[model samples]
Target: MHINALKSLVMDAVDELKGQDVVTLDVSRLTSVTDLMLVVSGTSSRHVAALADNVVEKAKQQGIKPLGVEGRTGSEWVLVDLGDLVVHLMQVETRQTYDLERLWSDFPSDIHEVRHGEQA
Candidate 1:
């Protein structure tokens, strides 16, 4: 699929697992590593793992392959790397500690917040 469509598909996959506090950041200008960074919170490690797994599965079902997946061992923070999109699934505590949103917050215009099945 096209990049935008792929991005929406990935976001949709994240939503499927009911991930909380979902946010999509357009980091394409800051880094070529990925075009979009999707951050989400899960209630627990198990939920984090499930969310990551489900996203990978769902993406693959649509013929989209991720470059890599990391942090499955701890599940405290799981990352799914698609070429143009990187997904971060974290527990609330871990997410707070890392403060990715804050670290990347400089690019406010790049952010698109989605939570509770609605956009902010």
Candidate 2:
């Protein structure tokens, strides 16, 4: 699927589960591993795991198999890799600790907060 479509699929999945503090970072130039990074915060570990599962389920329904899934055992921070886009599902504290947004702050990229399922 196209990057934009994939991105929307992720956003919708996250929104379906009411993920908080949704953020999207364009990292195509910063890294070749993935074009976009979506950071979503969940209330707890279970919430994080559910968010990741929803993303994976939605992707599969669309015939886009995920390359890999990580952090399922811990459920603190689960990452769903969909080739062009990587979805990061984390608890509030975990997200604050790693701070992916600030980690990539120095780079010239399009970073925006998503509110109410609307792209900023």
lDDT top scorer: 2
Give per-residue CA lDDT, model 1, range 3-111, as digits (tens): 7888778778878888888877767777778877889999999999999999999889998888899999999999999888889999999999998877876664555
lDDT of 2 by residue, 16-109 (tens): 9999988888777789899889999999999999999999999999999999999999899999999999999999999999989888876676
Spell out the clash pairs found in candidate 1.
none
lDDT of prediction 2: 0.89
**Stretches of candidate 2 exceeding 4 Å from the true structure:** 108-120
Give the lDDT of residue 88 in candidate 1: 94
| TM-scores, all models, native as reference | 0.87, 0.90
